[model samples]
Target: MKAIEVRFAKEIDKSFVVFRETGKYFPCPWHYHPEYEFVLVTKSHGRRMVGDHIGYFDEGDLVLMGPNLPHVWVNDESFINGGAAYDADAIVIHFQENFLGKEFINIPEMETLKKILDLSRRGLVIQGSAREKIGKLMVKMMTMNGLQRLAALMSIFDLLSQSQELELLASPGYTPRQEDQLKGPTDRINEYIMLNFHREISLQEIAGVSNMAVTTFCNFFKNQYRCTFIEYLNQVRIGLACKLLANEQNKIVQVAYEVGFNNLGNFNRQFKKIKNMTPREYRKRLDTQLEEDSIFFNEAYIVNE
Candidate 1:
């Protein structure tokens, strides 16, 4: 896959673009472009890569990615299965940073919005109360026109700026690389890791894939990604484990082995280090939240009917 992708949008009168997409999985590779993206995952669960950060995402996942931030979401097998039972969909909005004119954000009235846009350079996750509020607004915006749509977009950004649950992704000092000199090796390394993270991977083997010796590979990878190779691999494994744990039918021990952890102790330790909770506890929390959401949805359906 190309390291950087150039996306061309059809001519439209609006300053931004909004649309809904449904498919077995997100089709894009690990790629970046010049547009800032706001995405709300309405269905599906998967491992998402943003910059050098790898993590799990599920339904209601809301993320804002800045221009030239490489990102991709590789769906769990359940979502990729050719069945209606496990399809994915999202509402995606794309806009340029200066869509409202370069001087618009510098005004005192838009200080907060300006700050939010700056923070989005490393990507941001919009969560908690803001996710619910902004997500609904985005859905409505897809059906709106002219001033109404622009208002909805501003409202979403306002809520995001004030959100206490806003989380930053990627690391400081990481910038998108445009040189073809590094793109091939980086893409090869990423593809190799994603394909074989379910099995044991060695630094030497990965180094060979990057066509570097062990020591050179270590230095090169750290310089390029700002994270150790092992750290990246563990994140990928843990991300997959998260998707499996979301299914109540899977046991913790089963999920551990399924994602390349050989021992339950190591799995528990690494999972806690990355997710800050034990796998069982994480499952319980998700179960409780899901049940509550189900009840709320049923009541809403009855009221509407």
Candidate 2:
């Protein structure tokens, strides 16, 4: 899709921007910005699209994306449709690479921080104990000011640089087209597919969107995405299916059809191929994980008491 470029409002006193957003749902569209971003979802569950990577995000989901990476978080239907009781909330931090001045990052002491910034170009999901520690630091930064806030940000970066619990989101081969180079044939094709993936899309239809012959379009898509067009479509569908599966209220069959799978057998096969587990198993695992987290929280609270 052609992502819109979003510019941030500059603050005269701060080198970075940190704020908590709360509403019926996240209101951002698919967009890109020049500032690297650190995001922590404090409430809501939804699908997050970062570059060509699609995944489910829940409360406590944290990610860092380098400058100009297209991304958005769309809350679940319940949140958006006013069926949920609580509002969606997130804490976000945005800063340019030179926010602290180019000289500061070029110094020998900042080598690891520079490396982590470079890795973030593909987007990174902070995981394990690092996620918890960094999330706390982010929350603390909301109340901090001046040098204190900057120090906390540096601490978060240091943790990210040394920690082994980082997962890259976008595919290694994926590169976001810059604004100057957008509106190309491939970009149109991507927009069409993403907008219409919930229904049957024919080869001729996609080829028309790309302004190419069917055979030529197939070859071009394979070369550009490192996979067949069908494979890419299935990846997008399965990604959305995952978010739907997270809510146990949705039946597996309904989720499959909702995500554009016309048949149960095909959905099962594709889900297993991409996720390494059947839909039922994936849902069961999510439940088990939630239960474990609740138990851990209760025990920790009791111990503190």
The best candidate by lDDT is 2
Q: Note the clash tally of each candidate.
A: 0, 0
Estimate every model's Cα lDDT from 0 to 1.
0.81, 0.85
lDDT of 1 by residue, 98-160 (tens): 889998878887776666777676788887899999999988987798799999988987887
Model 2, position 86, has a per-residue lDDT of: 98
Tens digits of per-residue lDDT for model 2, 72-171: 8989889989999999999999999888787988888778667777777778898889999999999999999789999999899888867766667777
Runs off by more than 4 Å, candidate 1: 177-181, 195-198, 202-259, 266-305
Candidate 2: RMSD over Cα atoms? 8.0
Compute the lDDT of residue 38 as modeled in candidate 2. Answer: 96
